[model samples]
Target: MSNVLRIALVDPSDGSREALKGKLLGMDTIWLEADCSRYEFFPDVIEQTAPDVGVITLDSNPEKAIELIQRLATSAPDTAILAASEQTDGQLILRTMRAGAREFLTLPLSSDDLDEALRRVSQMKFGSADAGGRSCEVYAIAGATGGVGSTSTAVNLGCVLASEPQNSVALLDLDLALGDADVFLDSIPDYTLADVVQNISRLDIQLLKRSLTKHSSGLYLLPRPVELQDTLSITDDSIRKVIGLLKASFTHLIIDLSKTYSSVDMAAIESATRVVLVTQLDLPCLRNVVRLMMGFEEIDDLHNKVEIVVNRAGLETGQISLKKAKETLGREIFALLPNDYRTMVEVRNNGVPLIVQAPKAAITQGIRELAEKLEKGSSPAAEAGEEPAKASESKWKKFWPGVKQ
Candidate 1:
């Protein structure tokens, strides 16, 4: 045993504390300090012993465990925290992560789990010192509603950026339940955002890269699990930590946000340097866009950072002309993507991004052009009469090859 990995166990039960201490004793390199249940002892223990790790046991109630974690983080940011809970759920896991746990383990603990946690903590300590000058940038994409093609746009945008030689990009799927960035890009990561949250405190660039699923295009995807039952809930702090880790490892970070607003979503949006709000040219879509835009405006800082993207821009609905639609909103359409159901359908069914499968199609061209404009920093103009940028579309062309419009 190295005696370098000092540890602290925080469990109300004396039996569990002794058991945990015994487990640590097996490792030659690990040193067990005080077994404390009272929060009052934490600062004193930490100040005197300076343990490398702190494990909080969540037996009957987790709220106290969470509070202890927050206090420890404030007093001892250097200490790695592992939360052990008898009750584990998406929401509880999220709560633990946000409260400052580096790792969350279910009860009936094993040596294997404890060993892994210790290894991760040790690696985090060393990784931070070796990370050097790496930094990340944030990009956000949101749809006006269901059909604005924000997912597709975000997928391709990340792919395009990652395709650049010497550049790394991470695509974060923030849609808790229905995200398809992983499916679209054909990425199956071993871990999801849930895993990231579960292990957020110890997350450094190296750990983050390990969690990412690499795509052929060189883009890395942090996906939401396919099973909604799987953990997806994340807290603001966990989201920040995940983003912080990505920012250290990648040059570009693309976030696909859920249409519904949540604190997690707000954190991602706030962290982003640019926000692409995707919408379409229909009254219903526009009305929804109006509400979203107004809602965003309520947050003064975010309004200026948002860019409007009009999907399926030129679709004529006889009810309202493109020019009229633009006039209704006060801002210009940042980009206009054409509608092509066949290509979209094919892309979705094939589990491939539209840009990769149909780069020459009109919709693809529009997307590519939009990407180019974003690269250049010029916002595309909305058709006349639509709102300038109400804050906020496209196609299934390939999937339904036999169907004709």
Candidate 2:
């Protein structure tokens, strides 16, 4: 078999189609057999040319583009289908994959990522060994209440994880409308979570990696939508799909969830391998923890995944004790982060992570230890068969009358 790929291309956008054609023509391993500007004419072009691959761009008229893919998939069984789009939305990708597109490419493509996708096609056509699947550890970090330092904890933890050798970590700011994770990291992303969701259909590993803004700490971040209105389009299912895709590309996905406990937040929590609930030694925070724990218990053994961490520990001399805090939640405290106002203020102000700004600081060391403990998978709740906090049950009932024991 000749190594060169004979290609038939279809793209409705004239400019993008020409740009793609130019790229294909430049490749020594690809021969452009035919090109069509319309989806209606693509099948005829493919039939006449009998190219090794049929490249279809889906942005101009997605419904029709998808129809063309479906028709070509059935009518031309031997021709491998390659779907291209500017959008990377997960639903579109799933649909294209289901419609029998062997490879999906994102437009304004990177030469390297394009080459890699083509190489996969080559492997598939000529029968070569495919890459093995990888598993991802997802940690969802939520605050017991607003200002409990969940985002701070998540950012630092993600930085620590990224610092580890051979660890590819992504921090997804799922706080949607109100997330400030980008501000914490001092990253001004060209793309946000909204872009990823809108383009999810074409989202492959390459596209996902490109959509994120990489922090100096070696962690990739997907911040919440830049506009508040954009958050309305971000649904629970979309969050789940985004997480699923992120897992395929990264070793760890750290999610910073909003305190609203909305469906979107719950979806993230549901997908997490560990839910780190960050709180302070205060009545309001502890009460929120108890309420959240009660809700978590209802989800299939999810209580076992909960790990409570007290932030701002010893910030005040009269603050509640750790022992009483644990008793209130009916679970052991996973870790305690020391209060280091001066260092944290500087770290946040400078948009630098704790590990980088003050590696020797007590809070930094505390976060590093927390990362180690998480890696060891030593959750006290998981180890002991403890029921939901009966002590806080009455308080929970007062807040949520419909909830039963």
Best by lDDT: 2
Name model 2 segments beyond 4 Å from true. 1-134, 385-405
Instruction: List, residue by residue over 211-265, the lDDT tens digit for candidate 2.
Output: 9999878999999999999998899989877887776567788999998999999
- State the C-alpha lDDT per candidate: 0.73, 0.84
The sequence of per-residue lDDT tens digits that candidate 1 reaches over residues 118-213 is 667776875643222223457799988886789988998887777677577889999988898878876667989898888775654456688889
True-structure Cα RMSD, model 1: 15.2
Model 2 TM-score (2 dp): 0.66
Q: Write down the TM-score of every candidate.
A: 0.60, 0.66
